[model samples]
Target: MTTTGATKKVLVLFSGGQDSTTCLALALDRYDEVETIGFDYKQRHAVELGQREILRQALTRDFPAWRGRLGFDHLVRIEALAEMSQSAMTHDIEITLNEQGLPNTFVPGRNLLFLTFAAALAYRRGLTYIVAGMCETDYSGYPDCRDDAIKAMQIALNLGMEARFVMETPLMRLDKAATWRLAETLGGQKLVELIVEATHTCYLGDRRVRHDWGYGCGACPACELRAKGWREFKASPSA
Candidate 1:
């Protein structure tokens, strides 16, 4: 399916954070109509999802012109993994920050499950594209978030559903610095800053102090990634 003409429908797995929010902006520019689905997924910090909705509301408000052009669609929630609760994502395990390989916070098969659900919904709605915020470069290193995994999932999704759905990863190759650059180009630096400021990325869900770029608990993989990216951004402002 060629998305060459007017108003291609795009479905974004929005988290209302810097990466996903930037992806959302990119979708708006490319697609004719954009609809977002933010999943709660029984996460320890449900506040992230709340921040997602808050962003949807804020974006629709700011761009009142696209109030109808956009879609928050719905904030869906799914049950945590039942059997093994070793991960803080599903059970009461403590989610750590800055460890090394795949922290306990890594929800097993999360992106896979979320994409499956989102793909099923997109199929039902006859949408042709789906977007995610996962990035391998400058990442906290979640194996599932890699482009290879996404491609594999896309193949599986198509074979399973017998439909062609392109999973767009605008931030796939780009590190945090490149993401900021993309956002700056697509939505302006201030807009990107607003996206960072308004959204929440802290795993702990602490929105206490706002950074020049956005909110952070000054802890967790997400915070570390954001801060690292900000340092990169500061080092290369033009980017």
Candidate 2:
């Protein structure tokens, strides 16, 4: 069957972060029905889990156009990932580059397992598309977030589940600045404000110190990238 929004519903891997919120908005704009799925992997940034509900409420109140198209939201708790991972994301250890040259924040198989669980959920929910915000651009070198990895996961999910589910990565090629631009394009400044105010991206889960981009610790890699992106986004003529 042809993959089109008119005929297909979507399940978004929403973590209540800027990138995922943008992907959710894209899914809402493109699909007839849009559902959201979030993982409670017991990461250090657990604050984002609560922001999911806040974002949902804000979306319902601010963006009436998408409120009706929004479907059930699913929060899956996978503690096993935390149990197996000693990464900075899963623990309170310092965030730094490892001997392999990759950041210690890299939780192995995170995106892979996320796609697997999302595909399984989609199979049960009759969703044909799985939208995620896994971006290689403006990110801390996560191998699982690469386009090739996502495509391979799509193939593996289809073959393993005997189902055809399209994996949509709207921000796959866009940097963080471009991501912000896309959010403005989709819902204008309202969406951008919603993301900046409501979404959470700080790995340390710090919400006290608010930056122009959003609430983050400002020292971790996540906050640094977000801050840099927000500055660039604002400086751009299109923004």
lDDT of each: 0.78, 0.91
TM-score of each predicted structure versus truth: 0.89, 0.97
TM-score of decoy 2: 0.97
Top candidate on TM-score is 2
The candidate 1 region of ten consecutive residues with least summed lDDT is 81-90
lDDT (C-alpha) at residue 223 in model 1: 83
Model 2 lDDT per residue over 124-220, tens place = 9999889999888879999999999999999999999999999988888899999999999999999999999999999999999877788988999
List CA RMSD, all candidates: 2.6, 1.6
Error of 1 at 71 (Å): 2.6
> What C-alpha lDDT, on a 0 to 100 scale, does residue 113 get in candidate 1?
85
Give the clashing residue pairs of candidate 2, or none. none
Top of the candidates by lDDT: 2
lDDT of 1 by residue, 16-133 (tens): 7788898887777667778888877666666777677667776667654445668647666776543444566546656664355568778677888889989999998888899888
